[model samples]
Target chain A: MSEWWTYRPSSFLLFSARTYYRLFELYNAEIWPWQVLALLVGVAILVLLRKPGTWQGRTISALLAASWLWVAWAYLYSRYASINWMATYFAAAFALEALLLIVLGVGHGLVWRPPAAWISRAGIGLATFAVALQPLIGPLVGRSWSQVEVFAVAPDPTVVGTLGVLVLASGWPKWLLLPIPILWCLVSGATAWVMQSPDAALMPAAAALVIVAGGGSVLSRMAPARDASGTPALD
Target chain B: MDEIIKAPPLSRRRLLGALVATGAAAAVGPRISAAQPDAIITRPIPSTDEKLPAVGLGSWITFNVGYDDVARASCAEVMRDFFEAGGRLIDSSPMYGSSQATIGYGLYTLGKPPALFSADKVWTSPGSRGPPQIEVSRKQWNVPRFDLLQVHNLLAWKEHLPTLFAMKASGQLRYVGITTSEGRRHRDFEQIMRTQPLDFVQVSYNVLDREAEARILPLAQERGMAVIINRPFRQGALIDRVARHPLPSWAGEIGCVSWAQLLLKFIIAHPAVTCAIPATTRPAHARENVGAARGPLPDKVMRQRIESLVEQL
Candidate 1:
């Protein structure tokens, strides 16, 4: 079965850590031993997959493993040791996971590569600008900061997945990556309506507009015609 | 500050009558059987004019279990049982890992109760010199309107109290309270009660921790503000201390079957206290905690007996 089961080290690590944290809260000491066993299992899988990795993949994999370790440490520390510093440790681990993902994507040359014309590149740039501007506008408009995750020019899983598919199907304008931020903002804005906060709605709305308009402009510059080798002109 | 707000007032007597009618229709209403011989004690939230069972569940340690579907579903069942047995207050916080998210999920799946009193807190640094960061708290709890928003452990109380007061004026929150547990900030707790125009305050007030009664409880009663007692079990430390000993025979006279009831009943006996929130992960514990709400609260004389029972430990 052609299931969507292709392994990405970063995504798997993120999902596993999140799941373990949830289980830790529910079962506490009852499941602590099982979590330790799972950590070992995750390390074993990483070691087995280490051979076929590029420098970028290896680096990303190591960062992913580190994030999980941080999460486990946070859980243990909160349960058995210092209760006060647990939140700081958890937030730091979360931010590190986001940073590592961005670094891994850039290093692997996955982002900033346009499969289409220069217009598409410009469109992506505009989208990026829009996403970045969301936080500034959100508070002015009276939205909560948590809504920024949806509205701001932050990386989203769906957009990244789409970009990966597009890249593999046919090399288009590298700038196609730009619109992902815009798409995230739009979806985030729509979700904010239920939140019933003006600031919540405003931030996401602003982000969506920037990403879509800028990303559209960038995508427009790319030529559809293929070269003699049947690859697109940008590639 | 008195702007002659012309909102309709909720009648407590009428609301209580309506609630009792609904409780009767629900079939599993307050277990008032003569064989049980326990009168369920109910207390009113002065601000909202809503009466809730004296003992409520705290979701801090129990509900912070994260975002798993099965675990969340199990918690939903616990909440359902709690409400069916006449629970109204559900306490939570952003600081308890994914507790807010878990509560959001539970409330979503279980559907909200009309009389539900959602209480949460904003935990920031103590010496911080800015606003209480209300926006972050709103998102974390996933509630548009929080019934009671407390400053967790006097952390940035001066900063948060003003914002909470403003929210109260805006009709976004019905009550404003402050909480201090584990005996961390008695001085700050007394200071806030003395100065601020708060509607409620929460502190650790089990049989073991009666220091609040000396000053804090009387101050709250004088101020006419309700009180919520947390850490009634001393974060399970009290339980560990009293585990080997059997419950004294008189505990049954007041309808307390377990040590959990003995602890909660002692807290509820205080005149200033409106409710006591005990955190428990097990559903049976939730049921037993709620059962503490039933029967006659120990009188001043009996209160001394209950304390003496624990003092033996």
Candidate 2:
């Protein structure tokens, strides 16, 4: 087998940028009314995140799991696989991520709590960007609104959203869940860069921001507990 | 094809200065009249003596538009123009995303041009999967049978080669061959070319990438095998690099009005190359590519001149 160093990222790119954008246009048309529903689900997740609790955490996880499973089956398997053979493997990995989320949510793994620091606030902002601002990038970059990648539907925003959600989480779930979305963002960022898309930096940048926040969440956990007041409190 | 790019008349002193600077005495080379050929230029396939057009269409990234109807219709237009311009061969592989299905849509939309020469490839592992993949590729192209089928990138060639030979012997396929690109696997490529009874071999060769000239071209000539040249423009990078410069004044000796045609003429002018396949997404570019086959080609001296000038650029 040939070594990996011999090949460039563009060598594996089998589709044109125009074709890639058109894929989303056609997909959006085919799955009409679902975009509306997916957006509603995203809004519901945001609402749940505002008031963190055990039940709210599980509900948010269930919502995210449903979105991941839908994207794996419909977008990756049914659509993207037609052009790229690698999408099959991507769909399988996405399905696995969804299953992991299901276990963390239903198996009573971790409790969702309000952030005590600016890092968690940044995570919330990143999640908001994926759900709200990311779609606007398409039209701003000369693509049509029909081709805008939406959260809970497209892989880029979904992965970004998951990373954001993970930053609001802690314990083993945060450690276990961060790798998949980060890897996806890096892969997709390289792909978009090869395609010369203007918003290519968004995914990789979101991944970086989440990694910092997730790390901060860990450091906060190790530190002495603090109350609503500025001073440290008894455990 | 008849359009000649007129250069400002240079004085004897200027012509000599340009010639010295460019290291080409192309001004004094044997000059063919700048007349387009009345018929499309063709070279004989060494194995069966079948004449294939010197220029063919390649579907790499250009035709992998997936299921977008708008993009698919645009591709159909490109194909329609290619056929009307007297091109015969259209090449694709299963590795090129949805290019095969896109080609099928174009063929079906055009009601299947009788002049279409369908060339495809088998790219799967373990060799047993070759037949099923080939069947799917045939269905995708909506063709009765492929004119040529090659093993892509030499993957699983040990197993795929025998399967291709059997298909060719049974007449289910017309030609059997193998392909490699970007200059990888040439040692194995050379070994296969020397040993296999292949009808065609597709390789990457252009003005800049001349690794093929040292051994592969000569080997193909020695073995009496046909050669299909891929990436004549280095997948559009070469053209982009030279698009801003004016064509060397001596280019008119071969009737090349555009850099695209000049680079293409450089490839097919070689005696061993049966065809050069250049992929494009626009109908105008498709028409321009086939125009390379319609005029006088660069002679040995002029081919050398083209290489030097492009190298400097």
Candidate 3:
């Protein structure tokens, strides 16, 4: 089989999502062979980055394919009769998580295998910025965010802004990372109080908690492991 | 290979039953005679008295099979069989991916059946329903004057109803209805049924799903509006559940050869239900579904049996 045929599951998922989004926008569904072909290309690129003769590459590739399959299955299930918009929304969220897992697994596959280049670094930066800005830009520009006839601009910056700042500060010294989670929690909690949707509030609160808990473990590991001159032993 | 061939053959008694069932189908296999061209069970339009087939094709997941030449050809064949079998009302919408196009292709290929009852919808949020969206939907379906148009899922019902009414008055549309499925928006469904002068109401009511019976069915009956039942098999979940079990002996009494007939009979048994649209992709499935329209429907006792059997699942 050709490389494109190997990633059939990913192609199906991309095709389904694109079909749904197109149907939602245009009120007519059209065949999107190109979208399916594009997803196959993405899977091929991810697979090519893996080391040869290693189980890690095979495992990561399988995971990517499985995630895409799950996303496609979820999308199909959501389209069934008797499911509401809320259920559909949650199913779509699961699809997004599956996509994120593919990204993370692909990133892990490339880790320590090759020397990181400026282009790779810039790509990572771009991805990080996009992920961090989702909540900030989503509430403002996202068509689904508000109920009003005329689009209402978001009045307050979201918890994503705080996370974006923290990600930007991650390039600096370890001490700078300490206050980021604290600031994130305060802003997120305040936003949670103001937002109409519980989902909107819950997301930021959950992100804040993850940052604090995960960051604390990293801080504890860094503290005693530092050398006498206050530089990290690994460095 | 020797081990694989070890299974025994069926007994003579079982073989006889299969022959009998096949014979029964063959007896009723022919199309309606010229004397009764409208032989299929048809319910009337509330206002105009135009009778549509009691069993219509629901094109949801089936029509979304997409751009595959073989699949498209098969769909066209199924549709041709449907129309040749005296099917008139072809239900579709923008919600189902490429369903409208598939229906269009089938109708176009078959030279457009004279009594084509084209029904399509507009799915939008509340207060966003406007002429622009309606016009776009009209162009998408490629129908100059839709025979029956419905507001999809009560989407912007307040805004769209007036537009539909205006279109009806101006002869842009023949009839107008509002549809809500899955029993999600019953409150809105009830409100429309009570307030609006609708010709039909589409809902999800199957042998497995009886939620629509409480208020929607009775209200439609009382208001003298036609009712269309969507998801008659609960989107194939009911079929999967019933597959393991044998067809009850009593089901044969009602002339039901398969579970599809039994389920569809239950929906049509309701005087309120004008038609039930159950979607299928396979040609065999389509033939089986359309076969439901034939033969005697289940009476009160058999309907109770169906309800109990579905409840057991």
Candidate 4:
């Protein structure tokens, strides 16, 4: 019990950094041609978000759900759990996020409706950065491109990209979805910062962009949840 | 063994060479430390006549510095101080992040001592994952085998303990044990200790928490399983608590100078304890921790007096 309090925050951050750095190599080796499939899926989501017919919206949500499940199984349950036991809880959280995304985003027909405001523009920009620009971040910071972070593959960028889209979406109660993404960002950012990696800035910067784009305000105005009729849902 | 310190800066080849010649070769069973003339007081493993230094080092969060170069170097220095002070039995768990790796690095840099007892834990689920976790831990620790492999916190022990026993039978490891610190799972731990074919058992024991004294310690003594006492200073809480009050006037009677020594001396004083691993990141504190290993240990009367003083404080 006393040992629990004796932990220095740096110890945790340090563990996070080391874990992430190792993951970069492990993931890249594990997913190669699949990377092409993921990239195409990411591109498809963006294209669908631009036009967002009912089918397109459902397809985009389905794609995000698939990504979350993949990461949960591949990274958390199968790999990270071997190094740290707490990864089981992390996997559970990602699995929960996947289920929620399916229920709220797909079932409810939530779609990206990037408004013509700075916040929307910035939010879209963050979303784009998480998918496209974020991969280039490692190279710019002198990290090899081989270790580039990809959306739907890595936890950090996936959360960031999700936040950016949530903040910009026309959907109500995206506030309902902020907890997991926000938690993941804080977690990944702390890990990267402690490791002194370039990706450290990605999560925090995405978080700030979402807040500026009215993520929190929209969340505050929205109830914890809503029904099809737009009233707060009762248990 | 002396040739390690007398040798030049170690390369991977040199590390492997020293390992093949000294560390790995000499680690058949418990070997006495000649690094320091008066080896730290030791207790025997009842199953095997292996005598372990009563003071070991625990790699909890203190040694889990990930890949931070500076922090890793600090760990190496701590290990160096520990080695010079007649310490052995460096314990770690996979749950502690990069601690096993840090210990590997420290051992590589310091050149493994014959007295070095690499103790680590396999912490994962499902019996199948045990072998892989052990493999990873070995790679991280840069050793082919560990002296003692424990099931951390008794997670999946029934599933994992058999794997450990098989490994021990095959000579991949020397001893098998289970560890639960901070008094989390004593009932289960007691069951394992009482019934299982274990060589050692680690649990939280200090002047502050004497719950172990009532049963666990006595059971260990009776069953003849070597006991590794952890959380010796209550993770520095007891030390801080005692430091607030003056050191008892009878401090030197057990060769105590610092608060750390006082607390450690109390735990190591137990006849049941084969070792008390008090972890620290700083070299100076490591030195202070190892200091308790030397000189006269507190007798039973001294142990009671020290515990009472600490409880009052």
Q: By TM-score, who's the top model here?
A: 2
Provide TM-scores for the models.
0.55, 0.91, 0.59, 0.62
Q: Rank the candidates by lDDT, best first.
A: 2, 4, 1, 3
The candidate, 3 or 4, that scores higher on DockQ is 4
Clashes of each: 35, 0, 0, 0
lDDT of 3 at B149: 76
* Superior by lDDT: candidate 1 or candidate 2: 2
**Model 3 in CAPRI terms: which quality?**
incorrect
Clashes of 1: 35
Model 2 compared with the native: what TM-score? 0.91
Tens-digit lDDT track of model 4 for B268-295: 7777888899988788788678767655
Ranking by TM-score: 2, 4, 3, 1
Better of 2 and 4 by DockQ: 2
Per-residue lDDT of model 3, residues A1-235, tens digit only: 1234333221222122223222222211232333344344334433443333334544433443353344334232334211122324434543443344344433333222211233233323322332334333444544342221110011112123222222222222213322433443444344334332333454455455445533553465456556679877775
Residues B163-221 of candidate 2 have per-residue lDDT tens digits of: 88998899998998999998988999999999999999999999999999999999999
Worst 10 residues of 3 chain A by lDDT: A147-156
The A-chain TM-scores of all the candidates are 0.30, 0.94, 0.27, 0.82
DockQ, per model, reads: 0.02, 0.67, 0.05, 0.11
Question: Judged by TM-score relative to the true structure, which candidate is superior, 1 or 2?
Answer: 2
Interface RMSD of each: 17.1, 1.3, 14.8, 6.8
